[model samples]
Target: MSPFRKVPAYCRQSRTPIPFRQKQNEGLEALNTPLGAPRPGATRRKPAERAVARTIESDDADSLRAGRRRLGVVLKPAAQARSRNKLERLLEVGLEMMNEIGFDRMRVVDIAERAGCSTGAFYQRFADKEALLEALAQRFAEKAWTLLDTMLIPERFEGQPFAVVVRRMVVVMVRLASAHAVLLREVVRASLRDMRTWTYFSAMRDHMMARLFEVAGHYPEVTDKAAPGGPIELAVQIILSSLISRSLADQRIIAISDDDYAAELATLMIRYLVIDDAPWDAALSPTVD
Candidate 1:
């Protein structure tokens, strides 16, 4: 015998009625509803809950963009005068805050407040604190490069004795280091935590090394030691490290005075690189008749 059960026609018709599907239609309608609108047959979310949802969505979007930015995204500079001023103000305030409380403790909200802007404005330019720091690091790198390029030109030291040139170079380096001492110290600390920071500083070091090599080429004694990764490179590294350490360290605790430290560093470079005469000195000296 076939075991088959037949539904009553009336019950079958009731099951397929339009009203029964209306609930399902309402659910679909709810899914299609735009944000900030109430769903059919559903209670509206509280204002706080709606706000939290918006915040989450906004943050998620910002985070995705920030992640992309962290991975070598290039942000465009502001072209409008007002935007440029705001950007500069934000950076200046951020630097001051970072110096005062250090990067780890610095807050974007505080930076915005100090700059007379909103946190939203800060995020518009810098995706996050790390991005802000990267900007500052780039700024410092550019300034340092400009200073080194101007000061280390071979022609500038053409007639000067080698020791005098070394002293002048050391003074320029010291001035640069001292001017950005706090920011650099923060950068050093950030480098310990962030690979981007480390990469930036490493690039700066490489650039300065290249410039030093160019300058060293003008002196035979230094040039003789200037083979790639040679003693001249080592000496340059030592001079850079010493200047950075002195700038970041507490002067009161250090045994040497600033002048003495600068002099010693200059002497160290002079002796290490054996820069005794300018490249033109031998030619420029009066020949015996």
Candidate 2:
């Protein structure tokens, strides 16, 4: 029997349903509506989505705003092209150094020299190397939000088979992970020592799951919504965990190309969503066959 019989009241389409992309504005709306509030305004979200939104409160919002500000904290005003160019060079050189050498061993003087700027110039922009990492996190977050908006709009998959849509979502995600490989790795390594880092990554992951949940709402065939144990959020976490593990793992260890990896993940998601009478314990079944 399918577990998705009753669409949650919150997810039911309004006469003029709000698109998920616009519903979530890179943390702009902040979802002030609590669960079960009247749907009179533009900021309404389903309770499940609100559950995720609740995690993003004053602290998370402050962190996001701080990141956006710090990204532009160059020595001179970012309005100047030269200062902007130098900032970009510094970020590029810093990442190159971290990949070539370890983050701990990467030095400010070396980074400035490689970026063709003075050490004084680097200091004027970023207080220290950790600040640079914060900037990188902000940059990765921006790239991720843009990609999610572009790829997951409900219109793109209107006529596609469910399976194809799942695969497209997985591919878009895998590419984002590949693009910000270093930043993700650093977040995991440094998160224990820095709550800010952990908060950034965690908040991003929750927002992603929440967005995907909206996309799933469009397809009535998703028959597992009412399953026990927060199944939808759990499934999303499982998929994201795989992406993160692969992003951080040694290529030699995982030994699979991103393309193949994404295909396998798409399969995992489809099976998870379409399974029959399976409790969360049996969700990870033997095979698609």
lDDT of 2 by residue, 17-132 (tens): 55555555623545655576654456767898887777666446555442235552333445567877898999999888887876889999999999999999899889899888
Please, what is the whole-model Cα lDDT of each candidate in the order they appear? 0.70, 0.68
Backbone clash total for model 1 is 0
lDDT of 1 by residue, 1-289 (tens): 6487433332355565345356567668888899887665678889999999998887765655532333122553454678778987988898888768888888888899999999988887888888888888887777767766776777877756666666766666666666677877877777778778657667877877787678778877667776678986787689888766875788676776444566777778777765573222222221211
lDDT of 2: 0.68
Which numbered prediction scores highest in TM-score against the true structure?
Answer: 1
Candidate 1, residue 75: how far the Cα is off, in Å:
3.0
Model 1 misplaced regions, further than 4 Å: 1-73, 255-257, 277-289
Question: Lowest lDDT 10-mer window, candidate 1?
Answer: 280-289
